[model samples]
Target: MAAQSNAATAGTATVQGLLSELAALEDPQVRAVNERHGDDHGVNLGQLRAIAKRVKPQPALARELWATGDTAARLLSVLISRPKAFTAGELDAMVRQGPVPKVNDWLVNYVVKKSPHAQVLRPAWLADPDPVVAASGWALTSERVVKSPDGLDVDHLLAEIAEHMATAPQRLQWAMNHCLAQIGIELPEHRAQALDIGARLGVLKDHPTPPNCTSPYAPLWIKEILRRREAG
Candidate 1:
């Protein structure tokens, strides 16, 4: 185990060094935008990705940065992290720490859902008491359903949306709403069910939408996205 111990030590030192390098590259303007998104460390995605490419994939670095680094560092850590390095327990703890929704979104999309560990955590997270965890679970599930809807019980997903979309916490309601939209866009047979659920919730129906973007009011968003997909 001496070789293993040495490797671990070297890994930690390397990641720590990279974190320092990353901190020096921070931008005040980017940090301002990040603060608006609920994380304060103002690092832009392009800069972080460039640095991540230099550091390459390092789960050890990712974990250390996430636990101790600033918001920008943590974002970079997630981008560089190996999906296999994060355990379900670790993810649970991180989610419970009340990370900003944007950070959680990236972590869920880029790390948790991409890992094999997702299958083990999905059910637990969907039913978790923490609203964020539950939201994340739904978000990940929506992605899965969109990518590969075959063999998945689309009926169950639609039923869940109908049951929870109306009353879920704000974050969770958004994810559930997205799930409904995904069903409508991706599953031809279940499009009607999804549209019906969207109609029932009417979630964000009155929310002002940007001029060039489709409204995220589920039914309209689903139709617009599907149309875009077909045109592409």
Candidate 2:
């Protein structure tokens, strides 16, 4: 086990060196990688994303990257590299990482680049004791419903969400807006759950409005989903 840890560390070092070098390269692709790694090489996170492209989908990185990404350095390991899948053990660790707007950033990273570890990110993310992490879990749960409808359990997930609404209203409200922004997010059951939450919150009437949208991206979508809920 110690040897494996060493190997992982060595792999990370190698990747880091490669990324640093990649960062200095003039090529567009290399610069993009640098930008996402926080290398401000005249490119924004959005643009670098278009170029770096994740090597695989998530669940693979759950063990190596997702669970351990709390540290900026560790997260950087993933910015330049990704695991193929998440082990059962890593899921528990991911629960410890506080979810927030940055959590969404990683998801976008995993999604844009295509990490195989996306599967394990949420169940673990939401179960976290931290409301922020739970908010992140909610973020992806909403995304999963859209991108992979057959993949999630809306009823159970929402029940858990309702638990958040009761206990962590701030986080719950923040997640609500995130759910709205993802237009193509298409899990029918999950979408229904989001709408249900919106109706209860009365976003249209400008009442309390499903907790305050703490994250910048949450508002637009929160309003949109509420509109959809009312229209339907």
Candidate 3:
């Protein structure tokens, strides 16, 4: 009992210390900049990564940090947590929390993508009633479209994009657009159909992009990536 009490005390102190560190790192100016992009955190990603390096991987500690629900801390937790440790149900719960944009992006890329249950969860989440959860499912589908698409129904995916992408909620639309771009970039036989769908849908077609950066517009994005690959 004494040992358990002491261990709990130590864990509490550790989380508190990390929270203090994150607070110190926060900057009002950074917060303002991030808020424009729909992210609420103020700490720089590089600094968060550095902190993750200092903290040893501990799934319990990561869970505690995530439970704090502070964006910066949650980002750090993602960096240090063992991705495969989370069950499919836990991951589903996390996605439904509707974390701010950056947190959601990091959670999908850093943790959910690496989970052993990703494949099982993919189709289920894609069909979820919530747009955010459905967006996550689309994100995973985009990954498989590029990396491992043996059994994925390409025709069905394109048909869905044709039917829903133009009217999807903002985040879900973006994920569907990404999947459309990936299909064009990775699948030669389907390239014409992908390009035609992108041209007709015109999603993100005029979204401002910095000079020299590739546009997120699917047709343009697909073409630019193919150009780069050929140039290589």
Number of the candidate with higher TM-score, 2 or 3? 3
Best by TM-score: 3
Candidate that beats the other on lDDT, 2 or 3, i.e. the better one:
3
Model 1: which residue pairs collide?
31-42
- Predicted candidate 1 versus true structure: per-residue lDDT over 136-227, tens digit per residue: 88887888887766666778777877887788878888888888888898888888878878887788999899899889998899889988
Q: Which candidate would rank higher by TM-score, 1 or 3?
A: 3
Estimate, for each residue in 122-182, the C-alpha lDDT of model 2 and write its tens digit: 6766676666556666776666766675745556665654454534556556564455434
Give all candidates' CA lDDT scores.
Answer: 0.76, 0.47, 0.87
- Taking all chains together, each candidate's TM-score versus the true structure is 0.84, 0.47, 0.92
Name model 2 segments beyond 4 Å from true. 1-75, 85-88, 91-104, 107-117, 166-172, 176-196, 203-232
lDDT by residue (43-126, candidate 3, tens digit) is 988888777776757788888888988888888778878998999999998888745888889899889999999899999988
